[model samples]
Target: MTTPPHHPARRNLLRVAAAGAVSAAGLAAATPAWGRTTAAPASPPPGLSDPVQRGDLVVDVRDHGAVGDGVADDTAAIQAALDEGRGRTVYIPPGTYPVSTMLTVFGGTTVLATATTVIRRTDGPSIVGNGVLGDMTATGFDGESDIVIQGGVWDVNASNVALNGNGFSFSHGRNIRVYDVRVRDVQGWHAMELNAVETVRVVNCRFEGFSDPQGNRQYSEAVHMDYAGGPGHFTLFGAPDFYGCKDVEVSGCYAGPSADFPSYPRLVGSHGGPDGHQHTGLRVVSNYADQCTEWAVRLYDWLDGVVQGNQIVGGGGGIQIGPAGVQTGGNVVVSGNTLRGLAGVQEAAGRPPDAAICVGRLNNARTHRLTVADNVVEGVAMEGISVYRTDGCVVSGNVVEDCEGAGIRLHDAPRAVVTSNAVARTGGESIVVADASNAALVAQNRADDATAAGVRVTGTVAEVVVRGNVVRGDAAYGIAIGAGATGTWHTGNDLRGGYTTGPVDDQGSGSLTDPAGVA
Candidate 1:
């Protein structure tokens, strides 16, 4: 084994040209030409020098003895290439490379690939940026910066690996960019997981076919980012799970699950530390989600974020905010999205049925200052939008149609405004202010074609004003005030196409200034 002479960058091009003939001859001739004989050597190929550079030191894996034949395990050859590409660009040409082990990517290294290049992972994660490695550690920030992974196709085989798996595992990095990549057929855990990361942006990526064909014993998603175990490890694996990340954004991506599998693509705030770092400063915008098990966009204990302009379809629910028990997440905006065909659970009796959008706590007031506006929800299983036990929230200019439950309901939410919206074809009441909700203004809205009533003010509510609305076409009562409703002011509403039972059935003693002549 002889080492090459120390040559300058210009000599690198000549070496590449000289190696072309030897590479074309055969893998047999490659032994002496580059001074390598074995397929899986104990160390790197003998006489291999530092990666050659043209301008920015482009380390082509082919020059480093990678066959990329899809049958042979190219893990060792690719690993050696990555070692040479520590501070440079690692270029993968158009070929399918089979990997049986993980590829560690150090910081300041760009793993760029052509669209025709495919990295097929038979076992374990395809690429890992920061994690446990021997007794040493690489935090992706240990004197490094700007780790970019762009433009490749990753195929993950769930049947061949453990339950906790991923295509790209990037943790404890800053300014990480994963863009324009395609991940296909991820079966076990997640496609991408970002743990304890800051200032990361994921843009214009595509993920498809996330499921467990064996059974639903394990949950899987497309992308997960969070603070789970350590910054370099996992407590629980979720697709794009965001537990304690800050200043993250996911934009212009697609999360599509298999038709047979029930899984979510975007999961935020799934894991946390005992100190409770609240997963803040996130944005999910301009994405498309299909066939999710639960909410298309699920947020738990997240703060200071915006979920806008996303098209979510064929899921258990559309968007969900807040967590169970006493956990609260607030100061979020959900606007300008199309949520349709949600609520995957129709008859399964255990968990409460899902809604198009749900905010705040289920049993108490925990979240605040949430604005849900200008969204469209159709064919929702339960309520289109429910503000439960939250304060200072605004639900305005939204449209709900063909829902199984109430179009919009404010359950014990105080100081809320439901204005300028349209509700139609609801299975229950079109709009409801119930459960001790106080200081509510349900004004300038239109409700029609309800199985129950157009607007129902029930429960022990106070300081309620329902004014300047249109209620029409109900089989039962148009506006039914339950006997428990009190301190209600209902006025300036046009009640037309009187109910089958009666136009207005006001059982409560609330003040009413309407022309319907109901006592």
Candidate 2:
């Protein structure tokens, strides 16, 4: 692939323009010539700022006996600046610094570079030059404790470049930021991996060229978080392992082209192991995931996190909440997002179809309190939302269109509240409640142009409250309550399509009072 050119002079001019803006009073008082704002002095080139104007201890990586041009090993020269300790800035001049090994940043070190400064690697093992990877497995030194690596291009030739590898790796240090950078071409795992680190923020970054054709190994994820991978025959780490890494925020980033199939990307998650206590208090917001072969965002296990305001398109599933055999629960909310063109029918083309949002088992045999609400789903081949083996969850206020299976599905869950959703043009039932016992509520939703019933409740559903809903243009019955269902109260609902059991009495012992004469 052809690389983009880096212009230092243009960057310098932009920086001057940014710093040149002044208050109206100051501009008028200082300079009135030519109607321009303020008179500013000419600034030096980006990396060539005077020592007095530069940050503390500016050690140029190229001047410290390092070489660029996609060759020559500059690991030692770069490591020297990291060894200088806190409150120092390492300046990388405008050139491509090829790395064959990982480079670790120590506490109080700031790596500030121009856009022309590129840290890259050649094709080799997953481990390659200068950027942080498996070779440097130390803690509290890779962008931790007020360390910042900003304003540069980081091109990864290999995959799995991690700042801290696993749970054994811990950085108590805080306030780390990797901002305004570009990371490209990671072959395995994540482009940027942070394990058990505190207060880490990645903003305004781009990760590209992460693909695996053979599918032998997992391909690329832009940003990854988890507890350290644990030991023994079982490879994955448990949920408690990542509890140390809290308050992690990843915003305004992009990751794509993860696997051979354009629809699936590698899984992104905080929980890695069977223990089901890994990640907690995390936020993955305002990001974009395109051409992913798998899930766009996967939350394995945790509590109190928001996956909001994201654009996820062309993935196997937009979001997979809790995988089977994991207990991820408590105050988790997935809201206000746009997920389109999810490929769910390909997995079940011959068998029964599935849903778009697949909520798997609760963690450690425990129920969770989940809220999946206020999202727009379009062009999904399966159900719009699917719940499996979860309890005390609310799936409400979502709009789904052009789905092949049920719009909202409840399977083997108890006490779930499905309300205020609008589903249209579905090939199957608009809402299906299956095997849910102990009182579930399906209320105030609209199902239109469904081939089957608007609501189908089956398999031991008890004490269900189907109230204040509208069903129209269904080919079959408007509502079908199965034989085993008990104590169901169908109250004040509009059923435009005829019912199979004739006009059953409202379970609340109330009469239909609407002017249309049906409820």
Winning model by lDDT: 1
Residue by residue across 3-85, what tens digits does model 2's lDDT show? 11233322432443343365434544664454442333233345544221122234456445666555677777766656662
**How would you encode candidate 1's per-residue C-alpha lDDT over 400-509 as one tens digit per residue?**
99999999999888889999999999989999989867879899999989899888888888767788889889559777778887767788888885588986777776
Could you list the CA RMSD of all candidates, in the order they appear?
A: 8.8, 8.5
Question: Cα lDDT of all candidates, in order?
Answer: 0.70, 0.62
Per-residue error at 385 for model 2, in Å? 0.8
Q: Kindly give the number of clashing pairs for every candidate.
A: 12, 23
Model 1 RMSD in angstroms: 8.8
